[model samples]
Target chain A: MYKKPSSRRIKKFYAPLNLIPILDSVFILIFYLLMSAQFVKIFEIGSDLPIMADSPPSNMKDALNLTVDVDQDEIRIFTTVNETLYKTIPLNSDGTFDLTTLTGILATLKGRYPKENAIVIRPSSLIKYDDLVKILDSVREKGSGKSSIDLFAQIIFGNLGG
Target chain B: MGLRFRGRRQKKQEFYLELNSLMDVLFILLVFLIKNYSANNLNIPENIVLPHSVASKQINQAIVIQLTSEKKLYLNDILVADLEKDKELADGNIITALYDKMVDAKQNIKYKAKTLGDIHGTDEIVNLLMDKNLPYKYIRKIMFTSQTAGFKEFKFIVEGKE
Candidate 1:
């Protein structure tokens, strides 16, 4: 029982895990995701149908019902309150809308009536959707980042006669 | 000479790739891609160029209506009416064909909500994907048709840009 222990060492057998299949699957998944990825970001601008009545409701009478009339050559800013004309900004010499002037006017109006949120946009048949969106962008906000001021957030699409 | 030959054989056998680092990098990439993946299923057509805007409101689930620059009207990617040919079919401002399609779509959504236990209910919302170059008259017609079809809320889908 006390004899010397054998000097022969015991060997450990370890089987390596094959990772080829996992790598193949991972590569396929990455390729599929890359193909289906949405590169362009899509967003939305909300609007409401034009009210049938010529004037806003009694409750909204005090609020500034701002209306923007976008034509081919000029953008007319007005309010339903007493049918007042605020400003008329003509297109630039390069045939682009003067959005900076429109934003300044909207900021002034927003400062005057902070509670009023509704605004009606009436784009003429000649104005393109791109131009209308640019006008909308300018009317929705004034500055950028933390200093940005929200203008008319409630947008209503109105017809020419409405 | 025998020891030198054995050492050369061992060196040849040890020429294997170290893939642990590669696996770690791939796993990180996979996690990143999965996290940033968007589930938005809106398939904007190639011909319809959405207008760019600073509006950051994310798009919600709603019935989609597309208007191409060619004046083709599509409800959920199904061509319902051609503004060029169906000019007479427009009753005042509403496109009759589009209105019918929208009513059908609304009914289908309601039925799905009832059967599938969806809680959103009939919100009467419609998302409009329009070409940037399209005139406002076409948009007016679409909006009138949608309103007549009982869609109260409208959202314009546009490409997001700084």
Candidate 2:
């Protein structure tokens, strides 16, 4: 109030810094990254190699190696040695497999052919990668709600996964 | 004196924010990201995406083969074969170059199982870091090449979620 109206008076008018806008953007960016980042995860799903150095055929000719292949539409389960079709799990309306159903079928297979431990999963060239893992999960773990059942823990690749 | 009093009143009118809580939240997020960032470095490309699964095991040390959605094949981070083009060879089912690379790697470590006491049981295993959606054929071809090279086991690197 006591300052003179001189040419240097402009220097006295200090513009307050508005960091709120910058802080808002930075907070938004941090939240976005936080929401997207998957923490404490990354696992290995090992498949027993069918063609090991001493790879020997199963003695039980009736029971065959399981092979699961997927196309753009549905996932087909088969036996590799004889190329026999066993089951087909179709994709849902949203282009997703009924994983629960697949898990049930796999559980039943385990119950019948308890000796057969290896399973081969081969997704088609046109399928999305995320969906393929989901299928693997279904094969590896079963039983929802309260209890968990492990199935076909010894998964392996077909002589040729393709 | 009046001018000084007016300046003090202006300072009193300006509202201040408590940034301690904000800093705390940001620090927590930063620590979380840094902790789990290693999972993203499984020789997978930035554009590539793996599948998420709870059924996972700890990854072991072995030869790493990464197949991206682009059909790009990487053996231990070195670009080896493009599955899009190198689908077949006159000699056998696998790509000639991949087979050769695998063989070279095999010869180096195969005998180590005997010498080093098989600390990781790595002499016969090949770790596969495949895109979830890649076709089964690529996997088969790679498996063939790996088998020809003498690897008898495979472990798939999958994104783990608990």
Candidate 3:
């Protein structure tokens, strides 16, 4: 006679995982990150000292050589190649530099001379650094986001009185 | 009746707070924070209000030169000189104290590069953090000094205008 196979049931136990300690550690980590986080974004604008070359590069012989002279009352945009004065934008009636006009003029120049990438910035001794940076922002590019275009990206710090 | 009441009380179910979802949310938060964490060690001084710019170039590790609104100069967070006194000490357009400091910094960088077996010296870049209200004369002097000390690339640290 064949014996019938005995059926047995295995009991499985489930244990709760301890999470209080993990929660404490996570809270500590979050607090530390929040304390050390940089809330404000910091960035850089690069400028180079004019190269001490005897002659201009062959490709740049007829370049625009754009130069911007910033003063307390007015900003003069001119070309160093032929000393051609492009435009002079004066401060607004509210005592602020007219960046919109500057940007418009820069965009026009960029359209006419698309290959010219260098811009010489000569800020007067009286011009504040803040104002100079505003001028730089206006000169660096036009528009924003996807439609933005670089006006003059190669920045050179012109001489004190040049 | 008292034994029957005691048996009923003993049969009451135990309650537990579920935490798996909270743990999952915390893990996601940790990953997000870790992904966005930046290792830049540049510590902006409280007295120096950086100029705002639209330039998007991220700042890199380099020798830092800071000019506070009070005309104080700092090299890598160490108070090195007072600009007011240094102006009188400047030789022509170069600030003597800053020039000497930059020379020392360059030498230190070169020495470190040599120890690391780099034939060319480290990048000749300097990060300039100047107070927004500072006059360009001071900045000119600093740039001239740094140039004379063999630093060719200048990065002006600015607050990002988003």
Candidate 4:
């Protein structure tokens, strides 16, 4: 230390101070915020619910409505106008829903009827909310052979009974 | 080798700290985190497990309703009603208490908009944050109550994936 003082007194020039430790601390802080940040992606599924209006119901009662019936063992798809069944897909062995077939069917239906954008999801009272959400996810989008696109995005939450 | 080392040591008597490479790595990490970090202010309750979806749009400013797994209703994080407490309330597809709560919320928004000179359009958007395992009856009741509360447009808050 004493020898360094003599050399400093002789030399007029000195090296600049190192700021690496300060930079290191700031970088550490930045990393903490980066890792702790939620950065969550929140998406919305838009729907229009029936309001209590002063006027009577509109003439659009004959509108094309694609209804999905959620059952414990099977999921039934059909149209309101024609009460005939469109398809019957049974649940998986583990009791979880199978959306692969649902996606294919909806894609074909969407291709045929591009104007029909409304899909009413009427889950049974016994069905779990998770299953209801899974069904909605399946109908919300479809693959168009080339790329994935939105299917019946207008999700209508059906009320009790018909 | 000893001769070469002695010559090199004599040439540079000053101590040099090489931190440029370490700083470069830290800077790269900070940039990556900053790019992907989303500034989300959505204060979803810890107990509320949002449904998952492949695609969901970013949430906008709206009336937020949170329903926990216990079938508890929360308006803007305020606990308004607990379905488990009242069996009668759970039986009906439309909940009157929730409707009243929403009406109050709508009135507050309307008053704020009026004072601020901002006009809300014909439709009012309601954001829903519901648990993934609750029954469909509770969901239907919530939707019906929201409709009765005078909100026409609705948005479901879901965990989004790219």
Q: Highest lDDT: which candidate?
A: 3
- Cα lDDT of model 1 overall? 0.83
**TM-score of each candidate?**
0.84, 0.63, 0.86, 0.75
Best-to-worst order by DockQ is: 3, 1, 4, 2
- Model 2: residues with Cα > 4 Å off, grouped in runs: A1-40, A51-71, A77-86, A112-116, A120-128, A143-146, A159-162, B1-42, B84-92, B111-121
Q: Which stretches of candidate 4 lie over 4 Å from their true place?
A: A1-36, A50-64, A143-146, A160-162, B1-23, B117-123
Model 3, runs deviating above 4 Å: A1-11, A17-28, A59-61, A160-162, B1-17, B117-121
Tens digits of per-residue lDDT for model 1 on A8-114?
44455455667778888888988877878888889999987665787647865676778888888998988866768888999999999999999999899889888
Among the numbered candidates, top DockQ falls to 3
Model-by-model lDDT, in order? 0.83, 0.71, 0.85, 0.76
Best by TM-score: 3
In model 4, how large is the Cα lDDT of residue B60?
70
Candidate 3, A80-135: lDDT as tens digits: 57868989999999999999999999999999989888899888987899988888
Each candidate: how many clashes? 0, 9, 0, 2
Candidate 4, B99-130: lDDT as tens digits: 88889888888887878765542237888889
lDDT of 4 by residue, A44-150 (tens): 77777633478754644554558878887888888646655899888888878878888788888888778788887778777776677778878988743347777
* TM-score of model 4 vs. true structure: 0.75
Give the TM-score (vs. native) of candidate 3.
0.86
